[model samples]
Target chain A: MRMKRLACCLAIAAFTLPATASAQGLLENPADLIWVSVSAALVFFMQAGFALLEGGFVRTKNTVNVIMKNYADLCVGVLAFWALGFGLMFGDNPSGWIGVTHFVPGDLTGGEAGFMVFQMMFAATAATIVSGAVAERMRFAAYAIGAVAVTGVIYPVYGSWVWGSAFEGSGWLSERGFIDFAGSTVVHSIGGWCALAAAIVLGPRLGRFGPKGEVRNIPGHSLPSVALGVFILWLGWFGFNGGSTLAADASIGKVLLNTNLAAAAGVVGTMILLTALRRPVLITSSVNGALAGLVAITAGCGSMEPVFAVLTGFIAAPIAVFGGDLLLKLRVDDVVGAIPVHGFCGAWGTLAAGLFLDEGLFQPGVITTQLLGIGAAFLWAFPLAWLCFAGINVVLKVRAESIHEQRGLDFTEHSEVGYPEFQTDLPHAGRND
Target chain B: MAAHDNARYSRERAVISEVLGSKLDAAGVQSALDLWDRKFAGQKSVPLIEFVNEIEAVQALEARERHELRLALYKGMIQAAAGPTTTAARATTRATSPTRPRVEFKGTPAEIVFLKIVQYYGEQLRVLGPAVMQQFLSELRAALEERRMPGMLGDAMATVAMRGAVPDGVQWGNTARMHMLAQGLYVAACKAAGPVQADRILLGAVNQAKQLEAAKVFAPSQFL
Candidate 1:
């Protein structure tokens, strides 16, 4: 009887041992935790890039104003995302329309916290894009309020439709095989659409058009700052796309390579196009081309082959250039070309993700899914943001008064000036008086 | 008494006609002159202030036209007080007079007229802020220098830049140069403030100079 009992215990041990080993293998890796944390840090650093890019693009009088908006939006965005956006985006999605649990995200696992932090940066990115489009004219307080609405409601609700299954039930869009690896449509295009709405409601800057409706060039103040900003964004994008894998794996090598190839292809394509059009190869347009490429590849970087990524980015140049001209013809003043580089290129990138899928190129069903997702993003983000801005305008006035605009927002809003030494002729330096 | 009244009426009518004739027809001019005469016919001397008040009360004339007429009348009265010297002779006297040591500006009529407009706008902008006036003059000088203006025009702009104002007794003889300078000022004001404020400043300056013969010849709209 004792020998039989011992044999039974050994049999039970044999059955459980492999199961325990498999469970241990499935546990989170320390390397993944470290990589994700570092990537989140890199993504956060993109805010500085945004600040420099926007500040350089505005006039000297409005430089400080743009920087302030960039800085403030991050602060407002992070807190709003932390309070509500993370949960709405990644919580239990019983209805598949919105997440219903995990508000404020307490007592989370290490992996969950890292994910929340990483996604928090993306929310901030979406919030900050509007600052550049509405630069030189938007009221600071109204912008802060708009940032809250974006991160808390607009961005997260849409994000849940694509990425909600991270914790629980799957989103309908993701279930339909709509693949957005790192959010060309989910992040950049949503922000771009919001920017479009805000810019439309705010109207063009004074004298941007002539009596007969001719377009005028409003050159940015600093090319060096713009160049520096693009370089920083390029560096940050490696982490942006690579880190989306959520693991320290060999796939990151392919993702980073594709991202870099796309950006390079973007610059080459822009230079070639400019030469073809008999226009000067301008530094600002070149940098903007690089950004457009980065935006375009963000959706498909994980799924696209290197050559297809290059094609995706190359095509984005004309979209950006002509998209800008289209806005001018439509009388929409998108300062710094945010609508073109982010919005139009982002949509193109989403479509490219479907067309350039590594599994098979130009799958009609996949392309249709991508088109639906892209259309949904514009429909969801634009009108919602327009209503928000119009409501904000009614309540708090989103556009600055013409008198205050003439004095520059830096002086009128912040009691500061970017170049005080050059302003020696001005009374009291930074003071409005 | 009737002869003296006729002489006063003829002198007043000439000044009024010169100012209002372009804006008003002959019937309107006659009505304005008759209204002035009827208002002050019994008085031994009519005060300039009362005369201006009566012009301001006229319903048919625009406020701008009334201001022009008032300015023209004041100039006529001053010329009459200074005796029968022609404008050229008075200008020569001022230039050569020992009591007033400052030299007179000897540019062409257009140049002098444009300079006066510049000074007028400059003064008006100064009322807004000294910095505004400085920025306007600086932009004007920059525009002048950008054209590589030669001779007296360049020298005049340099002096204006140095003084941070349009200096007295200097000639900017070329009408084109003056037009460029005015355009520069408008552009600068647009940058410093905005197009609306810039337009307001230009309109005010042009209205002040509308009665001048040279202003009609140069036409502020050309530069604008």
Candidate 2:
């Protein structure tokens, strides 16, 4: 009787062990992985949108240089994220300041790649924002180094502080209930503030300011291209805001609708302001206004009602316009208004989430928590970006020479021009003759 | 001209035109002619700037009218330089006083409209003082170049400069020109070099006139 009972126990143990291990191997839901992967692809495509938008807004003489810098951001950013940024953002955190594990994805088929790729796109996006602010002047070598530093350290360190634990017990910000729904503080603001820092370090482009410190207009090369780029970004924003949900569920529809509504509200609000101010109802400003709305809404798209989303966007438009003016007033030469559209508006959106939290969903100290997050992000991003750019300048000279600037970065740096057929008179043509 | 030389000349001309839009007038024509003789006729580099202690316009002209004025001035200069006995040469030899009317009337509808508006605004023009006009012109020009409605300028000067509250019935497309004309007249009324940069005032007036021309106005009264 004893032998028979022992045999029965052994058989049951054998049956359960293999099944448990198999289940552990299939821990992630296939549908979720697929959704996240697709979202990553959508996010990746935004790099192209950024390239076109930035390239089009800059002078035609520097289009190739803009394209090259944007591409380098992704290239350098992705590799940096893969090697250290992902781990630093998601590793086990006893200190709640930085991640300490998962350097290169230990599990290939365990759905880690999906998460890594999505996050990598976001890291690349953050890195690229500085490209526009410093476009037409930054040296490629310095820009490459800066891209690596931003993606590798400056961006990820702050990211870990806010989103390190993924809603678990990973970081101090998360512990304090600091909410940044889709990284208004983490991604956009970091990029925006960094752009501000970079612009300050680089100074204004040639002919941007007068001897008396007067502001001058440097119009973009092509509105049609800018319009198209904006549309692409608008379309990709679904992935930007929607994919943040990290699921293929009903919530995506609401997030997407909120994103669209805010963008539209931004356009209307900006146009109204332009009409009131006696400025032309420029398509360029409108596009930027819409982006401001989108950036602002990104923080609270998931938490707030659609109405608040519209309000957030409506208010963001003016902030973008005025904030850009403020930067110029201070002599910071942000070429693409990224500081206003992303940095200022990003903070507004993050705080708005706290003020406009859904009825009865508000936590006791969430607003304070949001402010802390905003202050922290600003303090971290701006100073670090300033330091990074300053330090890089010491090594590689962050800004292109004045002669190179007059020649256009395309011809001076890349030995190419975007519109060579039409650009027959290179700056050096007279000297060459 | 060689093909490359032509391209350079056109590019420089375009830059000058874009930068000096709507500000081109009788005085501007004289200045351009002087500049052409001193610089372009000798194949010298365009210095990319024209200095004027103070320039003001009593009327807003259409961009087209200012463009035509510029084209005519350039053509005349080229003819005078290329042939010493042409009518253009004779015209070029005549002394041009800043206050003299250089733009002629061919009785085209656009020119008639431009002349009429200039005449109307001339009566209302007041010299606000050069400093005030200079600052105002700077604000207005920046606003125009940015294609934004002049919120800063409007807020700062609308009470003193505008003819009246912008009418509710005004078409959206015409709003910029209306504000521009009102501001131009204010600058003209307040003309006198105060604290404003002379060159900025002059360049500002020329650009304002060019903008007016684009909006379909003709010759505006030039203030210097």
Candidate 3:
């Protein structure tokens, strides 16, 4: 009788104490902590999605090399972000331009620590985006150095201007009410703009352009892998947008619904456009359309109504297709259409967030603030990334040698091949070597 | 002795059948096979060298087609001889038989080198497909006209079009002209198939030339 009574009292107290503590604001609700932590894990799993997508985008000969770069993005990105990026991004920022305190934080409250893990995944994602853009030809060491630059300085510093108030002071853009609910501009566009600069500096892969300046098609090796990767990313986006709420609240349901609707709309839009244009509905382009939709909806997923989310995603398909064509016209060889899917579409999504707000759609001041944030991302990321790439080129020769390229980076850099039995041109017997 | 002759005849006929099948359509292949049987009806065995010579004189085939057919015949005969044999036995058979014909190039060292290089490029272009080969020939004609070597262009076109079988009464050009022609072929291969393949093709040609007695003194790297 005594044991049963004590057990009953303990169960009652366990339930009541959390409610009291949460109400008093002394401790975080356990449900909120679990949600954010799970979401952080989902975001981290996106690194594997990136690896598969990039690996599928390149030739079989360079697949291993591309996967290695993705691994570099996660491993190097995590360390760099933990050491310098977190403090620079979330530290006290009275200047409204950059963070001023908290480098390599050891002591933190539970909520701050969870936020740090979530943000660390975002930084790693920003670094990994460049890997696909510079696939097949960029030197491995140069890419690792580039990852460090992105995670350590470029992404965090730019991130500070928008999301710097996690610990103490506010960001200039946030102060101006620039609405980026889930970092369409902060994470995706920053990464995309950095990708653009790196690609421009690195130049195109060998034989990408013909002698007559014609654009040749260098299709990726595996469409199935690309499709699987997009699906994984789509799954991860749920946590990405939902977890940004920082609590297990009623709003997560609507945010996730918006996200899924946009992705579906993106696929439909791409298929319809391709059929109307008399182009074959390519699986590769369709998956990319799905990614474009996901990227576009990310900024506005929380604030926009479901209908506008569909519109945002549907519009992003054409933007991605046309943006890819424009890059080809400009002689830019983006391997996996990273520039269109992330950079251009991200900017559009940022704008859509302001334009499609449920409260008051298209408020002039909100639109202007969003525009400033978009332009600031481009202005800040591209030039600095370009200079970094050029500097790496001058110092360490960022481009692989013609001999190494002919032999494939897998054999030359890592001394392994993805599909050895299928390959007839072993690295040893080639004349260029 | 009678059983050995029967086995040899079967091997020779099978080799000829396999070679002709790749080069001709169904009806044409059958017709060629019938002609082979008729020609070698009473013979104990058709020597591969003699059969190749007979193929060279076949009036129904184009010169390039005959050349391709002869190359295929030689490869098939070697494989047939080595079939189901131990490595040592295959090596002994190859050493003792007259099936392996040594190609004798009748030209100065540079001319021999030129012929070997052109032949190698032609073979590689054929492997890359007919469209690539046609494009290369078109490019070569334009390049030759730009260099104002119309007479040389005609000879070059004839030699390449005929799979490097030089026309009678033609002059073997100097090393410089050969180098220029070789470089043109390299460029065309690179444009069609990319540099990696072009380099491999050129290296194979150089190695082929190095094996020839007459062209052994010439530097292979210069052609590349």
Candidate 4:
């Protein structure tokens, strides 16, 4: 009865708020929904971009492995999220620190199915981000297991605390109310951090470093693939940042503007820094910079002005490139910089929301509260993720195939190659290196 | 046999190093041991060794960022011995006119097959190249911008017009430069089209790419 009363109140509020507040911006709030949806389509399409980009970066032998990881992510991520993740993430709780038990189709307490769908997509995205970092060498089964944990447990339990109603007003749960108007922390970091953890465990790829820890450059197989993938991802950010508004309103235009500016800034940031380092515009670095900019702006997109957004992306670029190197120093072998861009920058994005926003930065000290929200999120998700990984590692005994790793997983596991014809020109196409 | 060979090689390397160093000094012997440790442990030298052969100087812009970058580099240089001149850079079909000289010329096998590819695809005389410039109106270009660059070769070249099977699953930027390169090669092949020895080798390479695509060894670009 209490829950139903909550439901009734929500339904009434949902109808009343949008209707009453419906004012006409040039883009209009309601029309923003279409724009936001289009943005989502781009983000959804990024899976392919990621597949090709990563495929091109690694040895061509691993190209099949690259596509497989992406394929598994979309297929499995949606399933886990839909089946149970939504219920735990948005459902009511005592402190919103963690959600209580609920699973299966009819079990969602959020009552509104739309919110669940949004959460589901966020969960899917967070889950997919890990595939890139773990890319070439991880066992297929282990990666699948990681996907399940992210969508079902790691993402939702943390998501609920900040978003859990503005419930129980201003406690650890409510005060910080994790102001992720979108999911820099909830989605990007969860994937990013998990990538960090997985990379640490997996160790570096065989030829990644030279003697005495000098890094060797492994040029991608196709610059065109990388370029195409980056363009695809750039198209996706419109949805990634825009959809966070969760309403079809004036916020849409601001979201779109901020998302675009930040991405451009990311490119600018990476290009400048890289040029300074005397490094050429690496397809990998520039592409990763674009992604970092996207991740940095995600939490603050709805609230920030354009200039601030450019700064946010610019800051994220160095953080991404260097942070990737930092992970390597820490002996983490993140194949795709997932942790740096998503995990490290996600955390920064959420916190930057407090530091950067205009007068509107989180409805007042909701900024401080947002920090608390992020803390709570860390508290909620980290241990759970660690345990989930521990469990998967124990059960699956997921180790990279020595022969397969040397041979490349594509032909070994999947019986496929990304470029079969390119083999003819090269002397040792099929011969295992 | 190879395993034994590798082990034998390792042993020889170790002996050669030790013998060479023993005549130097105690410091040299210690240094040799250190070198051995690194080699056996699979560590590379501290300073990086640059590969001189591998550097490719293909200066171009993001095809998505702008056009013309791809075309000027590819068509003006590799294909026509010149990338598209700025005036000719607008994406347009070349083989669209049936009367637009189907002139086939002959060269080596590599050249022979290039013409065949152009012969099969009517108007894409300048579509596929290394740089991402506006070239021929390609099924590939439209698909790339939409972020649905195909993984399979067939899907990449498949269009509403005269479709020929392009089997080389070499996924690169769908830039105008790349398109022009493809066109230049194919046209050269077409000009060489009368029965020739070079024809078989060129066709063989194209066929391999196609076979690989058929085998599902290749996937489309992750543009979308």
Candidate 5:
């Protein structure tokens, strides 16, 4: 009886809250609001996915630091996004440069609250992507500063250029008919390019490259953790992509199906390449391939054919592998290959949307417009990130000292360790060195 | 220093003395070792020897009978004063590892030549004394790392950029003439895009640098 009363109260509040005319029916439907809330919760759960993924990839000594960074991504992300990012991204601005309203979102209606909650997860997701790139050696203070900058300015300002229309007017990029049904470039590329800048500025971890410019392999600590993390991220992607629909319609099933197909194609494509190159069929590369596909399809999943989705994912596999190799050659030590999986593949997917959409690339100006958006994203993301990191580096040492890095950030930065082998008087056993 | 450090240092000193005995007279040998001690201070000598061995000038001498002697002098000085350290040991391990060293060019030949010229100037400019030199070198090292400038080029560029050859007591390095010499070498190397051209350009630049140093005109200038 009490549960019914609570439901009744929520229903009344939903109806009483002011909603846009277009959203009136949506506000009237309690079921739709519940779906949005549930979807937002699932997307928020992806923070755990990122935490495990990043933690498993870094050295055991730095595991706690990496996980801490992941947690902070959401903690800082939510506050920053609420205070400034949402307004900059979604508020009305005639110039189309930035959103000028909704700061702190104090007067939000019921529908707006649901929307804000959902978008908040995305803002957190973008911030979490950077945590993986600068994992072991970044200073906590530097990461915090970077998180705030990304959530508050770098991400939302560009988000205003693309995703602003869902709330008010579509960004100028959307005005040009650039299609990014979900953010491959807006979220992934922004974070990826930011990672690139941070990695470049941080230099490589000690001994990552030799005096003669020889590259060394720094393997992650835990494959099992990696596997679990990838699976969770894969599961969460259903909400990430499907929930973008913002409705419980039949089309969501197609989006989910397409998401899975692309992921499978990504695996097959990566495995085939691995076989051809005579490389081992390791799960790390496999997971990366699937992620690349997921990132690629994100731009067009809502509008693409299932077969084309597979092709997009298949193309993403090679792009991700080569993109990583390129960063290594450039001496950018992206710890989790975020630059390739997110930045490069994100750009490719955004452009591919123009190629595979119903009108196709042959359509006059569509390809050009998409190219413009892609170029704009890189031009905006890479330099702003470089400047942000450079500024932080000036205020605080962005990279840890050699001693701190050698001892591990877990103890040096956080005064704690993830594993308790010494305290327990047990053998040190976990994650291959 | 610990016993192990002393033992290691002594062994390195002995190896350097043996190597340079042929190329250097006794007094010259002592002077070189003093320079090394004054320059490198706390660093290890092993990597210094290894670093010089990687240099083309030292490599060219290796073709002659007195190559070991020439290398030893360079190695000894670097060990005693300034050259290599354990930090470089990690890098050396890769080069000597059973697996092939993953050799990639961090700097082009021109860039490396530019670094070598800078090192020579750094040594000459040491009359400015340790405090000034150390602070200057620290700034130079930071710049080099930021620019990915070769370590050899660090002190020279720093000297040129920060303390151009001037008559002021506080500004006692990077004279106007030295500025021209350094710039000439850098420009020559850049223009010498190919390997054959690199050797010619470097040799010519070094010759010009030597002439400038011989003149030793103390002129105040902002050529840098």
Candidate 6:
């Protein structure tokens, strides 16, 4: 399946050539297309990891619901991105803040399509993360609406400002030169913020708090699933970070190395802190912290040096650990620490881009540019998200199940149970009541 | 209930006793374990937080240097809220009622009609939560008696409110905008129900709250 995907993507890359050689100057090289295609595939696979991660975190009753949502997110993202979602996000009609673009290129080329595929994976990724964070009790239909809004509208529109909305130009697109080389602010933060809004509107899962409002530790049902999910996510990060390099150059190897190095250090850092604090090592924190490092290194993966990557990632772990608690303090119930791992750390990553980017990374004012990019993404995302979610929350019955029912999202939302019945169906016997 | 699902269970700080274990003051490990314990307890109250204030004590002892003192108390309470209750110094006048009333917006008395009725309805059910639990409760008792047949209220309310939190497509479809307003009453009703013994009370309360809130928002003044 992987080989076929790669071959098909390569075939697409070969087809963007124009009759005139000079016009080709404006287009991307085929290798970059290959790089993007592979990365997109990796990020796409993270959806599976997300499914298991969420399913395990929730109770046994809600496993199927979480898995189903992850599946639906991919469907929504593909359709939305292919349809008007892509056009609205990347179109050239920039009015200083927002704009739209059509999928059809006046004269179509396959290389550009590869970038579309790559970006599509990213859009899908952002969309999927929300499902896991807001899992278990949310109405499948209402949650689907939120997912559609994310891939179709939120992810794409914000994405267009930095990358090309429909077809990225050399200079301007989206809101005109919004500087996200890779989408730390654009992708991770968007997912994080949306998770924040949804969890808020939905309220805490039942029994998460006691009568006095003290939090109760809710343990996941599966250890292997959580561990495997983390490892899977860690493996996927190579594509998420390295593929952002856009080509198979030695520079990309640096991005990959730095990404791996950061994640490794993040694991060590979290473990050391956890142990020193004399706390048993928390798998959730460890996973989230490592993911945090990966997310932190994403924006500046190629731009910064190894030392800076270490600093950026090293800073990310503690921030996420502390940030996770901040959500509890604020009474915002994030199921998997989504707000801390993505939202808070995403913001930190963007800001770190400002502080860490050097000659190895970019020009002197790169810090300022990174700031502008991060700030604008927030200014654009936060209010719109709050409004969109709050408005829907007010209008619709956002909570599909009560606190008791929420303990098992699958039972509340879907018909099937997460854990399969160990015993098969018994011989049929009918009794009339 | 039979099994503990704590993934990190039994992995507490290792006590290296006999080997250099006799008097190893591993403050680093001790503090880390304490933080973990506090996190698990869901009570931010960590012991020996005073060391954070005393620089000399912290500086003098490396192990307790990075000690984090979490003040888990809420507002004025210095101690935890859930321990066994001590006998009061005096008989208390105020009562924390478990069966607190579900709030509602009673049809404005004769002088208030139509627009005023709608305003009151909006106030009671427009998504912020039924104005106040006390008022909502009194009005609910009256409204249920008047509009609903006593025997059939629960199932009916459950079906309707279970329809969902928000209306689809059209914004605030069928006065659903007011649904958000009733959230508070629903909460108070549940909290008032005390520790849940049956799913019926919660389901019934949610349904009733939704029904009352919905009626205020969905119905015309004449219906009220």
Question: Model 6: per-residue lDDT, tens digit, B54-154?
Answer: 32112212232133222211211232222222211121222223221223333322211122232332222323222222233333334444433241332
Off by over 4 Å in 3: A1-27, A424-433, B1-224
Per-residue alpha-carbon lDDT of candidate 2 for residues A1-433, written as tens digits (9 for 90 to 100): 9878765654443333221111122217777778878878888888888888899889776899989999999999999988888767865544677765556554545565677788899999999999999987899989888889889988888888887843223778887877787878899999998888889989877656654667767777887888888888888788888888887789998889999999999999999999999999999899998899989999899988999999999999999999988988887888788899989999999988887788544555888899999999989989988999999999889889644654578877888788877764443321222
Indicate which candidate wins on lDDT: 3
Q: Which digits, one per residue and each the tens of the lDDT, describe model 1 over residues A1-433?
A: 9878765654453233221111122116878877888988988989889888988988777899999998888999999998888767876665676765666656666777787889999999998899999998899999999999999989998999998846666677988999889889888999999999999989887656643566656777787998898899899998888888888999999999989999998888999999999999998889889999999999999998999999999999999989988999998988889999999999999999999999999999999999999999999999999999999999999998654555568888898999998854332346543
Provide chain B TM-scores across all predictions. Answer: 0.42, 0.32, 0.51, 0.18, 0.26, 0.19
The local distance difference test score of model 3 is 0.76
**Model 6, backbone clash pairs (residues 3+ apart or across chains), number:** 40
Give every prediction's interface RMSD. 10.4, 14.2, 5.6, 19.8, 20.0, 12.6
lDDT of each: 0.75, 0.68, 0.76, 0.57, 0.68, 0.56
Candidate 1: docking tier: incorrect
- Which order, best to worst by DockQ? 1, 3, 6, 5, 2, 4
Quote the lDDT for B6 in model 1.
55
Ranking by TM-score: 3, 1, 5, 2, 6, 4
For each of the candidates, the C-alpha root-mean-square deviation to the true structure, in angstroms, is 16.5, 20.1, 18.1, 21.4, 18.2, 20.1
lDDT of 1 by residue, B201-222 (tens): 7666666555566666765444
The top-ranked prediction according to TM-score is 3
Model 4 clashing-pair count = 51
Model 4, TM vs. native: 0.59
Q: Candidate 2 overall Cα lDDT vs. reference?
A: 0.68
DockQ of 1: 0.06
Candidate 1, position A188, lDDT: 96
Question: Residue B22 of model 3: what lDDT?
Answer: 53
Global CA lDDT computed for model 4 = 0.57
Go through the candidates in order and give each one's DockQ.
0.06, 0.02, 0.05, 0.01, 0.02, 0.03
- Per-residue error at A372 for model 6, in Å? 3.1
Clashing pairs in 3: none
Poorly placed runs, candidate 2 (over 4 Å): A1-27, A166-169, A359-364, A427-433, B1-224
